[model samples]
Target chain A: MSLDIFKERGTPLDRQSFTWKDMVGEPYSKLDDDAFTRVRQILMHGVEQESCRFKHFAARFNPELRLPLARIRRVEHHQATMVNWLMPGDQSTLETTIGFEQVAIEVTAHVAAVEPDPYMAQIYRFGLLEDFDHLYRYAALMDRLCGKDANNILQSYTDVMPGRPTSVEHRAPEDDLRLHYQKTRAAPLTKIHAALITGSEWQTRDYYLTVGPTFADPIARQLYAEIASIEEQHVTQYEALSDPSETWLEKWLVQEATEVYAYWSCYSQEQNPRIKLIWERFLSYELEHLRLVRELMQKLENRDPAELLPAEFPDPLSFTSHRKFVRETLAAEVDLRARGYDIVPMDQDSPASIAYRAQLNAGGSPSEAVAAGYHWRPGTELTDRRVRDAAFAPLSGQEAAQ
Target chain B: MNKNDRPTDIGINRTGIALSPLDGPLTAEGASAAPPSSAGSWQDAAMVRLRYAAEASEFGHMPPPATLRGLAKTAKELLKGHKANVLLDKLGERLAFERTGVRLYDGLIVKFEANGSWEGGPTLEELVAFRSDEARHFELMVQALVKLGADPTAMTPSADITAVESLGVLQVISDPRTGLAHALHAQQIAELADVAGWDLLASLSETLGHTELAAECRRALAQENLHAAAVARWLKAHAEVAARGELEQAVAS
Candidate 1:
C-alpha cells in the first residue's frame, strides 16, 4: 500500500482500513517485528482463547466530561459569591483566588515525570495549559475586583516552588520529598482522585482506537477514532517500556470504564448550585461518550446493545482513583506477576529494565533467546526467581491483553 | 466634647471618636494559638500577625513568588528549629490552599471556555470560593493590626506611614477620591446598605480599626471634607463673581 493507493481509496471506510497500516506500517517487518511478535502471541494464546465478549450499549451523551467542566464552573461561581459577600464588609477578594502553589507544584512534577513522549507530552501540556490559564484568569479577576493586587500577594507562595525537579529517587531517603512538593497537611483527596482519573484517561486514549471503526455517530466516531489512533501510538511507545503484554484495546476499555465511574461517583455529591449545574452537564456528555463507545463495541461483536452495556461497562467507577491506586498496583506487581499476569512496572525504573525483566521471567527459562526477545543484549540471566516464576506460569491471553 | 455636648444630628458617628488609639502586638498566647481565620474582614489580634506572614509571603517565602532558591531558603528557614517546624506544620494546611489559588488563577484567566458567558469565566460561585480564601487572609491581617492598635481613625502618621509606605505606590495610580480608604469605605457602605439592619458597622468597629472611627464617622468626615473642598472652590468663584459683578452688569447694559 503506497501513498497513491491510500490517497485514491481514502473515504472514511478507507481511512479506517488505513489505520492499521498507518499504525503498524506494513506489518511483518522489523519496524514492528518485536511488537508484532508480542501482540500476536498475546492475541492468539492470550486473548483469542479467552471468552471475552463485548456487548452493545446504546449511544448516549457522556456524563464524565461534566466533572472537570463542572469543577471549573463551581470554582468560578464560588468566587462571585465570595466577592458579593465582601462588598459590604470592605473585605479583600477571597473566593476568586485558588491555591497557586499546589497547582504549580503539581504541574511541575507532572511535566518532570511525564513519560517523555511527544504526543503524550503534548496532550498533557494542553491540559496543563488550560489549567494554567484558569489560574492566571482567576488571579487577574481577583486583582481587578479587590482594587488591590491580592492575586500577586496570594501567588507569592509559588516563589517557594522547588527550583529543581526533585524526584523521589534524588532526595535522601530520610528527607521527605512530599514536604518539598508541598507543606499540605495531607494531599487533598479530591485532587488525588482527579490525578488518578487523568492517568486513566491518558491510558484509555490509546486503547480506544482498536475498535473505533464501528461507531454510528460520524462526528463522535471520527473524533474518537482519530484520538484513539494517536492513543494507540502512545500505548505502543509505552508498551516498548512497560506492560508489553497489555493490548491497547484492553487498556482503553479499562481506563474509559474506570474513569467514567470514578468521575460520576465523585461529582454525585456536589451540592453547590453552580457545581450541580455543571456536574449535570458534564455527566450527560461523558455518559454519551461512554454509550457511543459501548454501542460501537457491541456492534462489532454483533450483539444486542443492551447486552453490550455490560461490556461497555456496567460499573465504570471500579477504576476510580489517582496515584494511590497506581501506588497500590505497583506495590502488588510482584504478587500479581506470581499469579501469572503480565504486570505494570513494580517501581520507578527505566521501562527497558522492567520490561526485560518481566519478559525474561515470562519465558520460564533464563535463556539468551528469551532475553533477546526483550531486545536486551544477551547474558543477563534471571537472577530473581520471583520474576522467573511469574514469567513462565501459564498466562492467559486476556490477562496479557488487559 | 462631652457625650451630650456632641450633636445628636451627627448620629452615632461620634460614639467612639475619642477612644484612645488601638495598640500592641497580639499576646504571645494568641499568636501561638491563632485560629484558622475565615476568608473575610480583619477580626482579631492573631490575624494581624498573619500580616507578617503575608509580608513574608510577598518577599517570596511562599508560592507564586517562590523560586528554587527562595524555596530552598524557605525550607531551610522552616527547618531552623523545632519551633519553626511547629509554625510550618500548623500553618501548612492553609498555606497549601493558599498556593492552590496561585495555580487555579492560571486556569481562570486565560484558558476558560468563555463560550457565550460573561468574560468566559468560571461561574460566580467558583470565583467566590477563590476570593473568599484570599479575603480571609486580608481580613485576618487587618483585624490583627487593629487588635494590636494600628489606628483605624486615621491613616497612621507619616512615621507610622512607613508601615503603609509600601502601599504608597497604590496612591500614585488610584484616584484620591476613591482611594484605598474610600474604597474600603465604599465596601462598608455596600455591605451595610442592605444591612443598615445588621448594625454590623458598629459590630465591626474593634475589628475594622474602627473602634475610634465607625463607617458612619468615615462617611461624615468624607462629607465634611467634600464640603470644605466645595467651599474653597466656591470662595474662589465668589472672588471672581464680585470682581466681575459690576463689569458684567455694565456689559449687559
Candidate 2:
C-alpha cells in the first residue's frame, strides 16, 4: 500500500476531467462515516489549494510556465472541488470546524512524530498543541452554544481537553517566524510536511474570515476572528520553514510531490468505499501532476526530478488517533513559547510578544470568555448534577421566597 | 421589440421619483453623479453561475433501504404503482426536525440559564419539559418510521430542506448574545413549524391508512399548538414590558 511517486504514471494531465455531477457527487454520511474520512477530505482540499495557489504565482513570474501551469491549475481546481464537496451541507460550519481542527491535531501530530529534523519536529509539536487547544475551545462552544456534542464529530479519536491556551498563543509576528529547513539537507518528508501544514492553516484562516461575519452571535464572531488570527500566524510560521533559495520550478515540483503523497496516503487508509474511490482517482491524477511537473522541471531548469523527489514517498501519513502522543506533548511542551526561530521557556519568551499579547488581552479575550469555567462532560457540563440542578432550579431570589 | 427583455431599453417604470417634477430631477441628478465603479457585463458573473446551475447535480438522493425488510417494503410500494415512499419520506423529515428541535430547546435552555427569564416568561421547569417533549416526539417518529421499514436517521430530501429553513432560527437561539425574550421569539418560529409539520404528518398518515400513527401525530400536534400559544404570550409580555419602559424593573421584580 505504498506509492512510488517517481514512477507511477497516474491519469495524464490531459485525461484529468470532471463533470459538475462528478465533481459534486454524494457526500459521506455525517452520522455514520469515520471522522478520519473527513480528516482526509479537509487535508486533501488544502493540499490541492496550495498547489493551485503556487502554480498561479509561478505563472505570474515565470513566462514560460503559464500554459502548463494553467492546464495543471485547472485540474487542481476541479480536484479541490471534488474533494471539498464531499463535506455535506448538513454539517454546520462550527461542526465542520471541529473536523478541521481534528485534521490539524492528528495530521500535525503524525508529521511531528516522523519528522527527522529535530527543529522542524519541534515546530510541528508546538503547532499541534495550539490546534489541540482550538478543538477544546470549539468543543465548548459547540456544547454551550449549539447544545450538540463535538465528540459526535470527533468520534472520541481525539481528546477534548485544553492544550496550550489559545489566548496566550497570540505572539508578535517576528516571534512567530521560525528557522527554515535547508533545501539541500532537509528530508523529503520534511518539505512535504511544511507545505501540507502551511496550506491547511491558510485555508482555515480564509474559511474563518469568510464565514466569521455570517454569524450573528457576537462571541462566535469574535472567537472566529481570534482563532483566524492565530491561523494567520501559523501560515507565517510554517510557510517560513521552506528554504527561500528554492527556485519557482523547484517549489512547484515539491508542491506536486506533496499532493501526490497526500492523496496516496488518503487512498490507502480510506474506509468509505465511495470516498475511497475518489481518493484513488485523485491519487492517480496527482501522480500524473507530479510526472508533468517533474518533466517540466527537467526541461526548463535542467535539473533531474529524481534528484529532488524521493523514489518512494516516506511512510504514508498515519490517520489514526494521536491522543496519547498529543496529551504527552501537551504535558511536556505546552509551556514552550516562540522567540524568533527558537522555541523556548516562559522565562526566555520574547519581550515584544509579551507586550503584543498584553494589548490584545486588554480588550478581553474571547477565547477565555467562551471557555470560562468550561469543563468537557460526556454530554455537556450541564449534565453534571451540581450544574444541572442549579441551572434547572428556581432563580436565587425566587428560591429564597419559596 | 420586447421591452422587458431588451437589455438597454429605456422602459417607463415609475419605481423612482422620476415622475415627480419637483424632486425627481434632483434625485436623478444625484444618482447619475456617481459613476459606476467598473464596467463589465454583470452577465460575466451571471453566465458562470448559469453554466454551473445548468450542470449542477441534485442536493442528494434518498438512500436505498438498509435492510431486506426495508427493501421489500419499498419494492412492494413501488410495485403497488403508488407513492408509498412519500409517506416514509415525510416521516423521516419529521423525525429529523424533532431531533434538532430537542437540541434547539437545549440551546435555548442554556440561554435562559445565563440570561434569566423575564416577568411572565418561561420557568426553568417549563423549558425543561419542552425539551423533553421534543425528545419524546423525535423518538415517536423513529418508532413510526421503523414500523414502516424506513431508516429513521437518513436525511430525507425534505429533512435536509427543513434543516436549511430552520438554520437561521438555530443560529439566533444559539447565540450567546441573545436574551431570553430573543430566544422565545426564535422558539415561536420552531413551534409554528412543528405544529404544521405534525398536522401534515397526521393527515398524511391517516390518508395512508396508518390510523395509530395519525392519532400519535395528533397528540404531538396538540402539544405543539400549546407551545405556539404560550410562546406568543411570553413574547407579548416581554414586548409590552419594553414598551412600558419597565423591562429592567419587571425583570428585577
Candidate 3:
C-alpha cells in the first residue's frame, strides 16, 4: 500500500529522552539469522531516510530549522548505528567484511544496470570494478593472514576476481567530476540515486578513514588506506551528478518525500514482524518530517509540496544479484577512464593526467603495495585469466613502450 | 509553554523557542510581516505548530532518542559482553549464510537466463556475475570457518538457523509465479541484511581482538555498502518506470 506520508501522524519522543543504556537493545545472533534480514531492512530504512533528511537540511538557510533538524538527524543517526551494530558478539569481522563486498558487488551491478542516466550508470560501473578488485585483494589477505579462503566468507556467490586493478584506480581528483544532471530535467530517481550513492560511498570512505589506522598488520592497513582513497573518489563522482541549482527548500521537500518512499518500501516488503515494526514507526516519523517540510515550503516558497514529488511513490529499491550485467560491463568498460563529463579508454590521456602524475609523486601508494603483496600468489588471484588478461592488455602495451 | 520559557537542561536542548539568534521569527505575523530576506528564512509558524503536536503527544510509543554518543556507548557495552566461542559460532552461521547466498544467486541467474531479456530488468549476464560473487563468498566463509577450527559443513545451531533463514528467500525465488520485480525485492532485502550482518560481525571480531579478521571484514564492508546503494537505486528506478507506465496506461484509457 502507498504510504501517504503527508497524512500520517508519527510517534514523537522527547528530544534526548533516551540514554545509551536505553539505546542498547538486544542484538541478533545465529538463532536470529532470519531476523538479520529484518535488521538490515530497519537499518537501510534509517540510512536512506536520514540521507533524504540531510540533503534537505544541507540546503536550509533558516537557523530556526537547524536545531530541530539537528536533533532529528542525531536520532536518525543513532538509529542507523544501532541497526548496523545489531549483530551478535560472535560474528567475525572478516566474515562480515565478505558480506560487505557481496553487497557492493551485487548492489553496484544492479544499480548500474537500472541507472537511467548513461553517465551515472558509467560511474556506477567504474566504481563497481574497483570494489570488485578490493574483494579479490582482501580475499588474498584473508587467506594469507588467517588461513581462510575468500570463498568462505563470500559463499562463492561473487567471484573473488579483479575488476579494474587497484594499482591503477588512483586518478586525478578532477577526473572524479563528471557531467552534472540538470536538476530540473533529471528524473527524481536520478537525483535520489546520486544522493543515495553519495551517502554510501561517503560511509565507506569514512569507515576506512576511521578503521584503517587501527589494523596491526601494515599491509592490511595499507590496503584499506588505498581502497579508502578510491571511495573518496567515488563520493566525488556520485555527488557531482546532482544539479547545483536546487534550492535548500526544494531539496528539503524531496528529502522528506524520499524518506517516506523508502520507509514505505521497507515496511511493505519486510517479512519479519519485529523489523516491520521498526520500518512502520520510522515511516511514520518520516511522514511527519515530510509534512513539516511541506508546510514549511508552502509558507515560505508558495509552491505546492506535491509538485516537488511524483504523483505516486516510485518503486521500492531492492538488492538482488545481477551477475550477467556486471560481467558484461566488466568486459566492455573495464578499461574505460573518467574524462570530463564523459568516459574514455584507459590508453587515451585526459586533462586530469597531471593529477595522476601528482598522485604518483606522493610516494608509497597503498594500492601498489597491495598489488605487489599478491602478485606472487599462485591461485589466490580472484579474476579469471581471460578477463584479467583483457583488462591489463593496454597496460602491457604501455609497459612495452616504457 | 511560553515562547520565553526554556526547558531544563536535558541531554539536548528542546526548548520551543529558537536557540540561535539568527532564527527569524517564531510567530506567524512576525514572519509574514517581514519582507522575504534570504538570511531571515525560517520555518513557518504553522510548521512549528506541527512540531508541538508531535512533541506534546503521549499516546504512542516513539523510538528512543538515540544519539551518536549513546550508540557508541551501546557498542562498547556490546563488545564488553562478547565471548570468543560465541564469536566462532556466529562465524559458522555467517558461513552458512554465505552458502545460502551462493545458492540464491545461482537460482536467480537461472531464472534470468530462462526468462530471456526484459525491457529494463538486469541481463542474464549480470545475474551470472552476482551468482559468481556469492559462490566466492561461500568459499571465503568456509575457509574462515576452517581457520577458526570449526566445521563449516557440520550441522551447528547457527548453521541450521542460517539454512532456514535462507530457505525462505529461496522459496520466493523458486516459485514460478514470482516476477522479476518481486524476486529483486526479495534479493534487495537479503543484501541489506547481509551488509548489516557483516557490519556487526566485523565489529564483534574487532572487539575480540581479531585484528586480521576485523581488517578483512572492513574491506568487505566497504563493498557491501556499495551493493546496498546499487540495489536501492535500481529498485527506485524500476518502480519509477512502472509507475510511469501505469500513468500512461491510465491516460490512454
Candidate 4:
C-alpha cells in the first residue's frame, strides 16, 4: 500500500487503546513461525521503545509538547509491550540473543543496500559486518554453552559466520561517531533509516545490559559485555547519523513518520494472519499517531510536517534474507575499520583505537574464548558423531576424576 | 568480617514478618482487613487462563525422520498402539534434559572449587563423576532418538518445555551467591525429577515393547537414584552439623 504519511488520517489516538487481555496476547511460535517474524517483532518493539524513550526525553525539553507527547507515549507503551511480549517463553535468553543479532545483520543489510548516500551506505555495511561477527560469536556461545544448534533458532534464514571480527570492532569513543546527514537535503528515507536503526541498536544495548547479568557463565557474561559495548557504539554512530541541528518538533515529526513507515513495512510483509492483523491494526494506530504528532508540530511551532515527510513512503523495508548481500559485503569490506567518521583499511586504523582495544584485550577476549576453533556445523559440535570439538568432548568417569 | 563466616551462618535475613515486628503484624492485619479490589473469586484468573489455554497452539511439532531405517522403525511402531513421536519426543526431552543437566554440574563444579565443600557434601571427584554420567546419559538419549528415526538435534515440544523448566534449576545452580548445599538442593530437585522422568520413560518404553531401550533407561534411572541419595545424605549431614552444635552461634547477631 502506497501510504502518503501527510494525507492519511490514521486511527484516532483515543481509539488506539488496548485491554489487558489484548496487550498480553499469544506469542508467535519460535518453532513454526518464520524467523523474520521475530525479526519484525524485535525491530518494531525497538521502534516503539524508541518512540516512548524519545517522547520522555522530548517532554523533559519541550514544555508545550508535553501533553500530546504523553498521550502518544501512553499508546506507545502498550505498543512496545504488545510487540515484545510476542516473543515466546520457550526461546532462551541466548536463543533470543541469536534472534536479536539476526535483526541487526539482516535489517542493516537492507538499509545499506537501499541507502542512497555512499558514506551512509558504507557506515551501514561497516556496522553490518560487526553485527555479523556477533551472530557468529553468539552462535558459538549457544553451542559451547548449551550444546544447541543456533540454526534451530535461525531456521536457516540467516547465515552463522563471521563478517567483521567482533574482537577488532571495539574502538575509542571518538572513532564511533559518524558524519550526520544534511537534514534539509537528505532523503526523507535517510532520516527514517537513522531513526529506525538507532532505535534498534539502543534497545539492543539496553537488552544486553539488562540480560547480561542474568547469565552465570563468565564467558556468556563477558560476551554480552563485549558485544553490548559495540551495540553502544552502534547507537552512537546511528544516532550521530541524524543531523543534531533539527528542532525537537522536527525530530519528533520524523519519529512519527518513521513509525508509519515501519508498521507499513511489517504489515506489508507479515505472513501469520493473527500477527498480520496486529501489524495492520497498529499501522492504523501509528498513522493516527503520526497525524497527532503532525498536528502538534503545526500548532506548537507552526512548522509544516509535510517538509519532514515524503509524499509517499519509500519501499517498505524488505524482510527477506540478504545472505548474498551479506556475503558480498563480508568479502569486500571485512578489513575495513572506523577512524573518526571515515571508513578505512585496517592498516589505517587510528592509533588511539588500537591502544584502547589493546588494553581491553590484555586479559583475553570472551568472544575468542567461546568460539575457539569453532565452526558452524549443521548440528552443533555434539552432533557431528565422527569428530566433536574436543574442547567440549565428553569425558569418561576416570578422565573426569583425574 | 567474621573469619568463621559460612554460607549457612545466618546473619540479618530479615525476610520473615516475625523479624519485622510492628510493621509486619500491622501489614498482615491490614491485608486481612482490606476489601477485595474486584468482585470475583480466583476463578476469574482461572477463566482467563482457560480461555488462553484453549486458544493456544502446541508449543511445537516433531520433525520428520532424518533416516530411512529409523523411519521404518517408526512405521512399525505406529502399526501398534502408541504414536511413535510420543516416544521420540520423550526421548528428545531426556536428551535435552541430560545435556542441560551436564551444564548444571559444570556450574556446581565451579562452585565446588570457589567455595569448598563440607564434611559430608560433594567432593571435586564426585561432581566430576556426576557430570560425566550426565554427559554419557545425554549421548545414550541421542542414540536412542536416532534409532527411533527422530532427529536428536530438533527440539521437540516436550524438550522445549523441559528446557523452560530447567531454567530455574539452572539459575539456582549457576548463582554464585547460592551455598554449596543450596546448589545441591537445586540439583537434588533435578535428580528427583530425573528419577521420575527415567522411570516413566522406561515404563513407556516397555509398554511400547522397546525392551532394549527400556533396559538402558532403567540403568540410567538406577544411577539417578544413587545421585539423589548421595545429595540427600550430604545435605542432611551439612544441615545436622549446623542445627545440632553451632545452631545458636550461626544465627546470632
Candidate 5:
C-alpha cells in the first residue's frame, strides 16, 4: 500500500497508551486522586528504571556524575535549555548527582523498551544515546558550575568496598528482589529508602511547567519547554491509567503524604551526607510544588488550601510482595584473549550480553542489519572492505591507485 | 518544383522549408493508421479545457450579488474588505523579498484555480529558507501549550486569537502551480520536476524563508511517497524490468 494510504488509514498510536496526556490548559488541580497516583507511579517508574542503570554504571566505572563544588560558574544558554531555569543557586550540584542519575535510568529504560521497532528503534536508540550525551554534559557543567568532587561518591562506591557477587548464574526477577532485600535490607530499612525510587512522574509535568523556563538560559529554556511538552505527553499517559473524575484534593493529599514519608524514611538512614542533602532539597521542591498545586486547585475548584492538608504523614514506605529469582550460573575468571588480563567480570548464563550478542550474531550482512534497523558501527564497513579486497582483485582500488 | 507541385496538388500542405510528406502511405485506406495533428498537443489542450470545465462546475457560482453587498456594508469590520488583499500583498511581498522564495499567487489561471481557498482566505507565506525556524515554531507552540498545563494534542482553538488566527490563514495557503496544473500541463509538470520539482520548491520557498536541509529531506521523503503512485507509469514504460518486488528491493538496497 502507498505510505500515504497507510498513514491515512492507520490509527494514530494512542498517546495515552504511551503515557502521554492530552493538551488541556486547565491547571493540574483538575487531576483526581487516582490520576495523580498513576502519574506519580509512572514518573517514579521512569526514575526507578533510570536509577537502576545509574547503579550499574557506578558499579562498573567510577565516573563522576557531578562536577566538584570549587568549579562554581555561571550557567550557559544551552545548559539552561534542558535544565530547569527556575531552579536557583547550586542547581549544578542537583543536576550532576540527582539529575544525571535520573537521566541514566531513563536512558536505560528507553533502550530496553523502545529499541525494538524496526522503523523507530534507531531513532529511539539515538534518543537514549542523546540522553547519555546529555548526562555527561550536565555532569561536566556541574563540575564547572561548582567546585566539588562530583566523582567523590561514585569513586567511593567503586573503590572503597566493591560488593561481591552472590550469584553464579543470571538471576531472575524473584531472585534479584530477594537478593536486594538480603543484601541491602539490613544495610538500611526505611519506608522512604525503598520509596525514594518509587512513585509516579506527573509532578514533573507541573514542575517543569511552573519552573523550567523561568531560570533556564535561552537554549536551555527552549530545550526544557520542548522536553516539558514531551513530559505533558507523559502526564497524559499516566492519567489514562487512572480515573480523571476524582478530586484534586484527594490526589494531592495522597501523593504528598506518600512522597513526604518516603523522603523522610530514605533520609533517616542515608549514610552519605550528600544523599541526605539531596533528599532535603527534593523535599523542599516537592513542598513548593504541592503548595502551587493546592493554590491552583483552590482557584479552579473554589476550595480552601488548608482543607488540602493531609490527615497524617503517610508511612515512609509500603513493601511490595515483589520476588527475586536465583541465578543459574556462577561468575568465572574471564580470559582477556591475548591481552594478559587475569580476571574480569564474566558473563556466565546471564542475558548481560543479550543485545551485544544479538548484534554480533546478526553481523556479516548489512542488508540483514538494515532490516533489523541496526547501523554498522563506524569502521566496520572499512574492515569488511579490506577483507574483501584481499579476496577480490577486480573490485580492489589498489590497481586504480597504482 | 515538379515534386513539390505534384505533392501540393495531391493534397499535401507544407509551410516550412523543412516540411516533408510524412514518408508513409496517405490514402483513404491507410488513413486509419495515420496519426492526426490532434494526437498529442491537441489532446492535451482538450484535457485542459475539460478540467477547467469540471472545476467550474464543481465550485458552482460565487455567492449571490446580495450577499456580496451585505459583506460590503460591514466593510470596516472586515478591515474594509481590503484586509484580505492587504494581507495577501504583505505575504507576497515577504516572498518576493526573500533570497530564494516564490510568490504563490503570481501567474497562471491554474495557480489561482488550485489554491482558490487562498484567494478568499488570508494570504500567508512560509519561509522555507531555514528548517530550524520552521521546526522551532511547531516546537515552541507544542512546548508553550504543555507549559500552560494544556495538552498539546487537545489544542483546539475554542476561540481565535487574532494573531494566531492570522497565522492559521497563512498555514493553509499553498502554491498554485502544484495545486491545479497536475492535469492541465502534466508533461510540463514532469519536465519541471527536480528532486522536489518546481511546485514543492516554490511552496516551501514561499512558506519557509530558507531551503533548509530538512525541507529537502522532507521533500525527498515526499517523493518516496509519490513514487508508489507513479508505479504504473514506470512499469508500463520500462518493459525490461523484472517484477515489482525486484524493483522495490533494488531501490531499497
Candidate 6:
C-alpha cells in the first residue's frame, strides 16, 4: 500500500498515560540485516535534520526563545542517543568507530556528488579525505588493540589508505569560514545538503567528545580528542555554507520539511516490513512537526509556509560506495586548500597559507602520533603504501615531505 | 511596441505589475530617480519570470500544507509522551555492522562487474541482486538507528569486527591477481561465517527481549544460508570442470 506522509498523522501517546518505563524502547539484539540498514539511514538522517533544525532556532536574535529551542534540542539529542545505542552486544567499540568513519566517508562522498553548490562540494571533498585518513588511523588502532585488520570492518569496500594525511588537516579557525551561499538564489537541495552535512559533522564531533574520555589508552584517547577537533572544524566549514540570512521560522519550516522528506524517502525505499512501519510512523510524526512550524509561521508573520519550500521532494540522499568518486577527487584535490569560495593549490609561502603553519604549530599532530605508535609497536604503518602513494601522487613534493 | 509606450507597458500585459520601471535613459542624476527604467529590458523581464518559475519549482518539491498541519498535530501528541531510552553500546555495534555490510556489497558489485561473467557460474544479474539485498540491509539498520534517535556514525566495537572481516573479502576481490575462483571462495567463507553470526545474534536477541530483532536476524540468517549454499554449489561445479579438463589431458597423453 502507498503510504502518504501528509495524510497519515500518527497519534502521539499521551504523557500521563506513559511512564518513564515506557520511554525506554525495546532494546533489540538482532535486526534483520535490511531492517537494520534502514534503521541506520533513518537515524543518520534524523541526527542531521534535528541538529540543523536546532541550529536554526538557536541562532534567533530573541534571547527569550533560546531556552525553549535548547529544550527541543535536548529532546532531539535524547532521541539521537536512543537510536545510537541499538548496536548489538556482539560488536566492539573500535569496530563501531570504524563504522562511524565509513559513514563519514561514504555519506560525505554521496552528498558531495549531489551537492549543487561547487563551493559546498569542494568542502565535502576536502573533509572526505581527512575522514579517509581517519579511517586508516583508527584501523591501525583496531589492529593494535584487537589484532584485527581494518578491512574486516570496512568489508574491503572503502580503501584503508590515506587521503590527505590527517597530519595536515589542521587549519586556523579564522580560515574555516570560507564562503556562504546566497540564500535567495540557492537551491532547496543545497540548503538541505548543507543542513544534512552540518548535522552529521556536528554529531561526529559530539560523539568523539563523549567517547574520547572513555578510552583507556592514552594515545587512543588523544586520537579521539584530535579527530574530534577536526570534526569541530568540519562542522565549522560545513555550517558556513548555510545562508545566514534565512529567518529562524524559514529554517524551522525547512528542517521539518526535510525531516518529512527524508522519512518518506526511507519509507518508499524500505523493503523490510518492520522497518518500513517505523519509517511511516516517523514520517507522520515529522509531518506533525511541520504543521506546528507552519502554524507558528502563519501566526507570527502571516506568511505562507508554502513559499518557503517546494511541493515535491528533492532528490533523495542515498548512501553508496563513492570509491571511484572519492578516489578521483583525492587524485585531483588532495593538495588544494579553501580560500574563501576559491579552492587554490597549497602553497606554503602564499599569504593565504594557514593550514601549513597551523599544522606545524599544533605540536606533534596526534594523527601522526597514532601512526607512529602503530609503527613503533607493530613494525608497520597504518595504511597500504600503494593506496596512499596513488592518492597523493598528484601532490608535488608530498613524497619527500612524508 | 511603439517608442512612445513606456518600457513598463511592454511586458505589463504578460507579467503583472512591473516592480521597477521598464524603460528610461540612464544619466547620473537619473540613477536616483526611478533608476532610469533598468527594469524595462527584456532581460529584466525574463529574469523576473525566471525567479517566479524558480519559486514555483520550489513549491513542487515541498509537502502540501495539509500534511504539515497533520504532522504538527501528531508532533504535539508525541511531545507529551516523549521519554528517552538509553542503549548506547548495542546501537553503536549495529550501526557499524550495517555500514560494513553496505561497503561489502559495494565492493563485491564492483568486483563482479569488473570481472565480467563467471564461466558457467552465477550471472552478473544474480550478483547485482545480492548486492541490492545488502544495500537494503544497510538501509534498514540505518532506519532502526534513526528511530531510536541515535547517531549511526559513532564508532563502536562491532564495526571494527565488520571492518576486519570485510577486509579479507575485499582483499581477494580488489586485487587484480585474484580471479572469480578466489572471490567465490572468499564469498563462501564470508557467507558461512555470516550465517553463524546471525544465528547467534538471533538467539541472543530473543533472550534479551528483542523478539522483533531476533526475527530480523532469522530472516538475514536464511538469506545468508542461501548465499553460502549457492557459492558452495558454484565452487563444486567449477571443480568438476577442472577435473574433466585434467581427465581429457590424461587421455590425450
Q: Candidate 6 on B36-144: residue-level lDDT in tens?
A: 1111211222232333454553211211111223334533333232121223244444455555555655666665555442335566677767766666656655665
Of 2 and 5, the candidate ranking higher by lDDT: 2
Model 3 misplacement above 4 A: A1-22, A30-61, A268-273, A354-365, A368-402, B1-253
Docking class of 3: incorrect
lDDT of each: 0.28, 0.80, 0.59, 0.81, 0.28, 0.58
Q: DockQ values for all predictions?
A: 0.01, 0.01, 0.01, 0.01, 0.01, 0.01
TM-score list, all predictions = 0.22, 0.64, 0.53, 0.63, 0.21, 0.52
Task: Give the alpha carbon lDDT tens digit for every residue of A1-402 in model 5.
Answer: 001111112111121011112111111111111111212223333433323332343334423412210111111111112122222222233232333334323322323232223322222222222232232222322232232322221211111000111111112222112111221111121222222322223334445565554432332333345344434433332233222343433343334333444444444444335334544444443344345445555666777644434334433332111001000010112111100111123333335333333443341211111112111111221223432253433312432443
Across A271-360, the per-residue lDDT of candidate 2 in tens digits comes to 889999998898898888788887888888888878888888758999998867886797799889999989999889999999999999
**CAPRI band of model 6?**
incorrect
Q: Write the per-residue lDDT of candidate 3 for residues B36-151, one digit (tens) a residue.
A: 11211111222223334555644222122223243344344433332645676667666777777777777676555544323344666666766676666667667765555445
Q: lDDT tens string, model 5, B28-60?
A: 112233222121211222233333454553212
lDDT of 4 by residue, A177-209 (tens): 999999899999999999999999999999999
Tell me the TM-score of model 6.
0.52
What is candidate 5's local distance difference test score? 0.28
Residue-level lDDT of model 1, residues A93-157, one tens digit each, is 23212332223223322432333333333233323322322233333223222333322222222
Clashing pairs in 4: none
By TM-score, rank the candidates, best first.
Answer: 2, 4, 3, 6, 1, 5
Candidate 1's docking class is incorrect
Q: How far off is residue B195 in model 1, in Å?
A: 38
Candidate 5 DockQ vs. native: 0.01
The residue pairs found clashing in candidate 2 are none
